[model samples]
Target: MTSLKNVQSKSSKSCYVIFCCCTFIFAPLLIGSIIYQSSGIKIPTILSSINATFSVENLIDSPTKIIATIPHIPLESFICDKINISRFPVSSTTQTNDSFDVYRKNVLEKYCDIVPVPRYNWSSPKSYTENDIAFVIFTAAAFFHTRTTAARDTWVSRITNYYFLSATPYPYLPITVVPGAGEDKLSNMKKLFYGLQIIYKQQMNLSPDKQQKWFYIAGCDTFILPHHLLKRLHGLDYRQPIRVGGHWGQHDCPGPNGTKFQAEFPSGGAGFFFSMKLLEILQPHLTNYVENVWPRNSEISDVALSCLSHQLGVPLTKQVGFWAHPPAFTLGENGRDKFHKEPEPNDFHYIKPDEMHALDEFYIYQHMDRLINDRNWSEFTQFMRRFVASHYELLRKKRRECTLPTIEAEVKLSNK
Candidate 1:
């Protein structure tokens, strides 16, 4: 019985030794895993490498540094909330293209339901007239002739005053030379500033009676529907210092030391309107703002102007029709063919160009007159719904057929 007691004691001591060894081996690992999960960092590997030197403070601080270096997601509120449509439906069971098409169709239907229809009488001659608004188009010399000529032939006649503003000389067109600014993106910002200066100087020189009521700045590639634009502007009090455009937000600007700054600005593609009064107010401070206050190396003209607008207390009003992206109906083979038709001379064009090459005088006006004059609001909406769905499907198909293969080839080459 005494020998049995001795054996039991030895067995108990062996069990205690195993328990102590297991705790020593796993306690640190368990703690490290908890820390990793909480901090969203790989703490186990780090702890293993620096087990002797690791401390609680180091584990906590490392994640904070990583978080600081990451770029922030842009705020949705900075831009207009009109196009924040519901996400396209997707399911694990379905193919990506099919799911995207379904989503696109759904969104097109929603857009058609809400697009505003013109209430003014189309048959009445008094419904439309040339206004005192001026179009200050920022053009490059390369496409200046083609783009400006297209504008003149298409929509320029609907407005009273318009000029193609460019750095290079276009002796044929009534071009306003904004010297010292180049044709690059950074130069575009400078060009806008200088153009504003010129406009201000002209205003200063003009008799009070002859001063323009509003100034519209747009890219050379932009196609604007003068009648629709005028109708929209007529609703606003131009005498007040107000600005309006297709508002964009949630853009991140890089700052010093791996930081990002959020920005909200109007898209230059859709065009932006500034009341004469607003321009007058901005004119005095334009030089100082551009020279001193504007952020360096910022190439986007819209963003620069937006920053200045923020500082000057001019709020940007968002218009639904002001499209920043290329319109849905203007993509793929059908869209290209559609834009190649000639529009009627008398009717107001509702389509605007988002790119230089999109200006097709022959096709852009195709069925536009009917859409503008013959179709009722409901009919117009339905037409647009069909147009959007068809165009987007072609776009998706093209991307899948052309773009995906190119991307795959690039990936393979990189892998090699």
Candidate 2:
């Protein structure tokens, strides 16, 4: 009986230990769950903040950092939201007059209606006149974090205020907020092509001379625009049907480090306008090539598009200064290291810290109440002035200022 009693006692102790172990293991988890629910915390948002903060440290922290460095954009933001492009006009062949006019007309005539005057409310308010061209920008949210409600409010406020206060309206330029699915990141991009096809078929079913216009897939963050490229397009055979793509920055090439460290492709963040004829051809074939190697995942979207175009047997037009190759905004050599090299007059430049904070401030202004709050409001307002003013000289002058090529080459290599 004594031995039986000892065995019972041992069993009871084991049960108690098991209960304690479970409690110890689950206590924090239970608490975290309650807090997460109560606080309305999104795991992705938290994770994005955590992920974006790591930077260079992550690349070196071996496999641990690599495993933790998954992209953390919110799930709500990832689900591809439908955006209607029906209102975007695709009329080609209105004029064959001026050389510059004919060049732009031929290149852009197929997928866009090139009018001398701005018909849409989406034109830049400051520059919107009777003769400004109306081109639609797509899925621009990735380029403009300030426009994203989840990013910096200051950035949102600045862009809005600049456009609105400046009296601008970006009407038909609907930003696609969702990330699409495919074997590659760009598999979802095919949906854009297919969606355009559906919209085009629905609209242009009637007219034999239905003017298909140019489709500008603009990268918002890039700040370069190559004028020589515009000049070159004038020389292409408009009847042959041509499409343009690339970084389309303001400068000549990627600064030093950008060329080396960054991916080289026909398209990138600044924006590249494609020919409507190309889209019409690719629209039908997009589904078959969704998993093809060209649209596969990579650091550069334009590069992927270029690759996909090649795989689909589409030819991409090559031109000098087409994409501002190195991109003056993010990865360029000129404006990146401001302390070391002075920016030329025309570069749309931002300081490193300023660029980082700009998106956050934009988010605060767009989605939160920091604008009215004194602490954030003052800082944000000053930031706007400085940010806008930094490029004020260039905007007013509108000159194509080129830096010394030797200097450009040197800055191209420096990552900073």
What's the TM-score of each model vs. the native? 0.50, 0.33
Give one digit per residue, the lDDT tens place, for model 1 in 78-161.
Answer: 011223443444566856644534534433333222222222124322322345677888777776546665564445533457
Model 1 lDDT, full chain set: 0.55
Off by over 4 Å in 2: 1-145, 148-192, 202-212, 223-232, 237-239, 246-264, 292-300, 311-314, 322-416
Judging by lDDT against the true structure, name the best candidate.
1
- Worst lDDT run of 10 residues, candidate 1, spans 71-80
Candidate 1 — which residues are off by over 4 angstroms? 1-129, 250-263, 329-416
Task: List, in order, the clash count of every candidate structure.
Answer: 8, 48
Please give the range of 10 consecutive residues that has the lowest summed lDDT in model 2. 114-123
Best candidate per TM-score, number?
1
